[model samples]
Target: MYIKPLALLLAVFLASLRLAAQTAPAGHVVVTHLDSKLLHGNPGGENPRRRVSVYLPAGYEASPSQHYPVLYYLHGFTWNDSLIFNQDGMKTLLDQAIAAGQIRPLIVVVPDEQTRFGGSWYTNSATNGPWADFTARELIAFIDKQFRTLAKPGSRGLAGHSMGGGGTVRLALAYPGTWAAVYALSPAFLGPHPSYLPGPGVGPALRATSAAEAQRVHTTLAAVSLARAFSPNPKATPFGANFPGSLGADSLARRDAVLARWVLASPLYTLPIHPAALRQLRAFAFDWGAQDEVKHIPPTCRQFSNLLAVYGIQHTAEEYEGTHGSRIMGSTGRVYQQVLPFFNKHLDFSP
Candidate 1:
């Protein structure tokens, strides 16, 4: 009887140890509500205060003196920062990768870039406020100050999907000295001289007083939003001066002017002009789905890649078997196997 009791106690203790190990925190996902002064008092009325999610690897707390490199992730059009952790399983994937020694542990940050018009495309605008500045300058400063980071451009990496991917491309080029490496996943590239016409009912729909009415028409609304980011005219009536003729006038001249503005913002056009900046990056890579639903994405990405090749800029470009937003979840292994390892290889993690 004594032997049986002892055996039972041992079994219970072993189970308890396993349970404790399972229940212990793998890492931390801290959500901080940041009030961006850079985004304050914008015409769009998008909330200046936004949530930024920071992922601290396991042992971050224990290793007080040790600093880690930082990776800034930009999300797609509709997806905000929180989705990276809550829905996409970023923390869990990172934990598993770190445990397996597949990738070196580092800090990851996701900033909210949602606007009244769905997504900001991570651009600076009179209407959308200085979103690029908010991300590149202000947010970086905040992260460096708050966390124990390597805090240098050489130690930093940027990655994004879709709109965020486009942001990574634009931001990396514009701020050449900011990030050492860049990975753009299925970036939404509109080409150098995109000819975008306002969809049916775009004019009357934008005139609607409420946000719901404006958002009901998806395609036109998205165009207007991009126009708001690129060519914002606060003086224009109703919802400010947007592309494809603001509100009333459907003149060809006005439309041409709008397209001209968009051309100026296009990475396809800007990349050729800024070859030196592209060459300055330590590492650059972009990938798109083989069957990307966005018709323009693959061709544009290929064109952009060709442009890079023309300029003798070294970069990685791949086509994967997935659609837009399909591989975002940790189930895909793209983030764990590809993105993290890319950053680990390029980013300087010393000291």
Candidate 2:
């Protein structure tokens, strides 16, 4: 379908006016969704909606005729399109990064990938929801048609944190041709680790004790839901059910199956399937706080790095010293620093 670039720009610009009243910084942008009534439930499902927040560099207006590569960012659970992507502080961070020569000028788009069960994990699922298609097809098409972006995979980068970090890893694996570089920050659980058992705190975190508590405590339950939701074993667990499958022996087995599925989907497990995809990548980087609450930060980082090493997939993995939430604020600037250069190194902006 044809999309008007000016129309998309106007829509976001107006939304930004409204967003300015919120707590976000001065230049906070708005991310909007355009649903496809016609394509709903097809391979990409109908309702091909695009939720995009764009950050243009300081001289974006002066150089009105210029075009730039785009950065696609996915937000964590509980955060809608506007929270991280459209926030004004992030825009200022980009501005500072560009000014300091830490990174080249570029556009960053953050979209909402949260599905019915809290988050899609950016995966397509009956249980977790159709976020994969929403992201890979719908969002990309809309942004390209409506923006002045350099409409090519090599000109693009994808990154996220927490649930979004999983989305980044999952999307990079699923559509190896879509992005030239990727960055993930403090990603959630990958799969069960026999050697990496959870601490006693994990009991409260996993909520393995009770169903209601599970719903309240277990963020890992989203992993299970994404498993059944996106890639289902219908025979193993019934459709449209809460994750961890209602807390019984059968439920536990089903949850384990979900974990097995995660292992299959994880970058650590499936990097071999897309060796060329990995090779095409200009950069792959992920970092987590040494004291991250959700997952064992160091081990997970090592796991991904070791897997990359085995496949000769060059990547950068670091263990920063911070927690999940706070570090993202401090590190987003650094992420832009890493990402913009990666794109500059890979994507040729000249026509």
Candidate 1, residues 52-127, lDDT tens digits: the string is 9999988899999999999999998778888778888788877766665667889999999988877888888898
The lDDT of each candidate is 0.81, 0.63
- lDDT at position 185, candidate 2: 78
Error of 2 at 146 (Å): 0.5
Location of the lowest summed lDDT over 10 successive residues in candidate 1 = 193-202
Query: Candidate 2 on 21-104: residue-level lDDT in tens?
Result: 343223335456667442355332223454567776656667778877888878886676666644625776665555545566
Q: What are the TM-scores, per candidate, against the unseen true structure?
A: 0.87, 0.74
Model 1 whole-model lDDT (C-alpha atoms): 0.81
Best of the candidates, lDDT: 1
